[model samples]
Target: MLQKIIFIFLLVILVSCGQETQPKPYGELRLEYPKPHYKLFNSNSPFTFEYSDYAEITPAKKKDWYNLSYKKMKANVFITYFPIHNDFNLHLKEAEKMVYEHTIKASAIDTQSFSYPNHNVFGNFYQLQGQTASNIQFFVTDSTKHFVTANLYFNSRPKPDSLAPAIAYIKKDLEHMISTFKWK
Candidate 1:
């Protein structure tokens, strides 16, 4: 009976391990972001991030975006910086339009919505969802006399309930880029 039990346990393990599924490595992601116009330089200011050395930042030539990639994590992080006056409503509207247009062209956004402006960032984040809602996250920023827009894309479905943690992780890197972002 002991031998039979061992055999059954081994069979169960084999069956379970054979299943095909998406691999999500916690605290790590895989993406291919476009490059920024300029190389990022170190700053003494608090607005800097401690990125892993394995990561590379490059400017995206095909599109108007900056791509940051992590070799170790196999993730793509893209950022676009738009410069504008903060107090101008017209500029804000224009920025919003640019972000929406970009999103519409990039993904299948069946439903589009915007959130209240984040006072801290002096901008807002918009969410786009289709049948599966976990594929994209969009943001617009008009901070420090600069209009910055960003989009995070994933091959996986981006339902907030399921992809929230990964989205959160991506945002951390995006935030770092935004904070250190400068136009040359």
Candidate 2:
């Protein structure tokens, strides 16, 4: 009986050893994003634009400022509106300054100019490539009165690789917003 038991135990051990111990085969995480659905943000405010239906807009402390929050994605778009009031140049400078402020941590900054001449909406969109607090910032203006600036920030740490999907997702919304932007 003892011989039989030992033989069985040794057989189990030998069989187990035949299987090579190996680390898991590396695989990239698959992150999926929902297809975008937009809603018109036509409010009593100074401007109107199209925004993602996923986001909920809440008024910031400032009268014309809003924090558009994406609860599931843990991100927010901080939007501030200033009526140019003959200070368009000042607002333009400040918008450029905000983008440059991220230069310390950005690997590269790409600026793309877009205009919807039919809507009278002209804008600059900046994509900050790196682990920065805000990955995207933009401002659209009629170049006469309405000046609106927005920043997109994730609630979590700025891990560019991990956040790339979300960034790309929100960018579509940004594009839609800019194209549909209109000053009231």
Candidate 3:
């Protein structure tokens, strides 16, 4: 009886030891976001644009600065308005400097120039890739009087892969806002 028990225990151990231990494959996380519905943002400020109804717009402490907060995505778009006041170049430099500041962490920065001659709106939209603090930055100005800059920041860690879905969603809203932006 003891010999039979010992033999069975040894057989079980041998079979278990022969089995290969494999690591589970990694899977991507799926995040679903609500379809955005936009509405014209009517503000008493110098300019107006369409914003996603999904986001909550809050007036920043500074004048002409607004925070478009997307709570679900843990992101915020900070929009700042600056009157050119014969300092168009100065404001342009400032905007460029802000975008460049993220270069340390950004893998690449692609800029797209936008022109709306009829509305006198023209500027560069910057898409920053990689683990950067700000994923997107843009500036629109009449090249004379009004200068506006907007930057998108996520409250969480900058993981481009994980944040791709949220980033893409917010990007569409930003593009829409830029397209419909008008000087008030």
Candidate 4:
């Protein structure tokens, strides 16, 4: 009787082991952003520009400093203003140094110069590609009296692949702000 029971159990196990297997499919996450609406940002500071309504603007510790915080994206654009007391070269050097400091982690750095003669708004925009802490940096000046620098930072680990969409969206807003910038 014991030998017969063991044979029956072995047969049941062999019958259950012959099923087919299926492979799991791969997938990617999709992110969508709202159409941007901008409003003119004017303050007691010496400059004015258009900023995205999606972001909240708050005063920084410094007198003329401000932060454009994007809560949904977990990022901020920090902007600082200074009076160029015949130290334009020094300011430019400092801005350039700040941007290049990320070279250790940045795969590539591309720069584009913007000139708005009518508004006296001229600047250099730096875009850093790769897993860098700050992907964007810029400085806009009238070359004699006013100097302004801005940098973009995300509040998370640097992962270029995952952050591409948010970076591109914010970059568009930054470009628009630069184009519409004016010195007051």
The 0-to-1 C-alpha lDDT of every candidate, in the order given, reads 0.50, 0.91, 0.92, 0.96
Cα lDDT of model 3 by residue, 1-184, tens digit: 9999999999999888965888999987889878888898888889988899999999998999999999989999999999878898899999999999999999999999998888888999999999999999999998878999999999999999989899899989999898989997
Model 4 worst lDDT run, 10 consecutive residues: 19-28
Query: How are the candidates ranked when ordered by TM-score, highest leading?
Result: 2, 4, 3, 1
**TM-score of candidate 4 to 2 decimals:** 0.88
lDDT of 2 by residue, 35-152 (tens): 8889998777988888998889989988889998988889999999998888999999999999999999999999999988988889899999998999999999989978999999
Off by more than 4 A, model 2? 26-28
Q: How many backbone clashes can be found in candidate 1?
A: 22
Off by over 4 Å in 3: 1-24
Per-candidate TM-scores read 0.42, 0.94, 0.87, 0.88
lDDT of 2 at 73: 85
Give the better candidate number (1 or 4) by TM-score: 4
Q: After superposition, how far is residue 75 of candidate 4 from its true place, in Å?
A: 0.1
User: lDDT score, residue 103, model 3?
Assistant: 91
Worst ten in a row by lDDT for model 2: 13-22
* Deviation (Å) of 4 in candidate 4: 20
Q: Candidate 4 lDDT, tens digit per residue, 1-184? A: 9999999999999998886877878888898989999999999999999999999999999999999999999999999999999899999999999999999999999999999999999999999999999999999999999999999999999999999999999999999999999988
